[model samples]
Target: MRILQQMNAFCVMTLIAFSISASVQAESPAPVQAAKKALAVGQTAKDFQLLSVGGELSGEVKLSDVNADGKVVVVVLRGFPGKQCPACSAQVGDFVKNASKFAAKNAKVLLVYPGPKSQLDQRADEFLQGTKLPAPLTFLLDPGYTFTNAYGLRWDAPRETAYPTTLVLDESGKIQFVKISETHRGRSSAAEVLEAL
Candidate 1:
């Protein structure tokens, strides 16, 4: 009976091992994802003018002022009509819930919404409707996706939209941290981003 148990365990181990090896062999090899062109750590973040419900977006918020005063958290959002983007809405809600935590860390948050200029105003307002954003958080719009192109966060899929990403820029406007998602599922959380800071 003892030998039978040992054989069973050995067979289980061997099966797992063979299954893993076969899976690896049968899988189509994936090419290495090219290093995407975007702001890297220690690189200076560029500036641009954005269309906003509040008027005067983009270059208005300087990275230097942010770094010299406190930290800057820039969250990018995919525009409206791009699958409802429940993930993005949830992400912003979560961050707004923890807005104070970011303030305690001396960071100002800017949410960047990118869409075509014609629809930017309406779409941006839809995202900010009735949401009590703390004073520290500013919602900015990228009309015509100039900022997306400049920041290298444009997603070129047929039915896709801009890349939903997060960037932490220092006082001098240099990127202290950056996170860009290829898929639509991920945009950094407030806790996750604060920890990065």
Candidate 2:
């Protein structure tokens, strides 16, 4: 009878231990995803397709198409956060003013406007109002942050859109220069980007 009682207690303890182990396993959180690396110079530029809600190119714009014919590609702009950014406006204006210079170098400039999914196209159009993008300078819309996330530039903060970035790509689609602004200030000027090209 004593042996039987000992065996029962041992079985009960074993079951409790197993239960605790299972509970711990269930409560443990899943492993976190690794952080995505930011795009940099010397790396091959990742190809992305985005709609041109407004500008010279009012259609789908692909990186491959931009790099076709050995044209240098320049990406310059900030994604719209809560509203249109004055800094972005100034930066784009600078690029537009220098559109002729870009063309001279056989380069194409793409101004990326990123925002949430809600009325993204409408917002992009509103932003483009009163600003004329000449030939070789186009505006791109990043709806729902698809391109932003793919490039690891999603700001993901309140009242913050994507990180202001400028990338210069060579004819072969390799990144020649990359500037990712930590703050709204320090945007790449057209001359600086042209120098990279």
lDDT of every model, 2 decimals? 0.73, 0.77
lDDT of 1: 0.73
Instruction: Report the C-alpha lDDT of model 1 over 1-197, residue by residue, as the tens digit.
Output: 99999999999999999999999877522321221344778877776655444421334655455456767888888877454578888998888888788878878888888877786677777777756677567787777878877776767667666777899887678788887776777678888899987
TM-score of 1: 0.75
- Model 2, 73-147: lDDT tens per residue? 555455667778899988888888898998889888888888888887777777788566797788888888888
Which candidate gets the maximum lDDT versus the true structure? Answer: 2
Q: Give the winner by TM-score.
A: 2
Clashes of each: 4, 0
Scored against the true structure, residue 171 in model 1 reaches a CA lDDT of 69
Q: Which stretches of model 1 miss by more than 4 angstroms?
A: 1-37, 54-68
Error of 1 at 29 (Å): 16
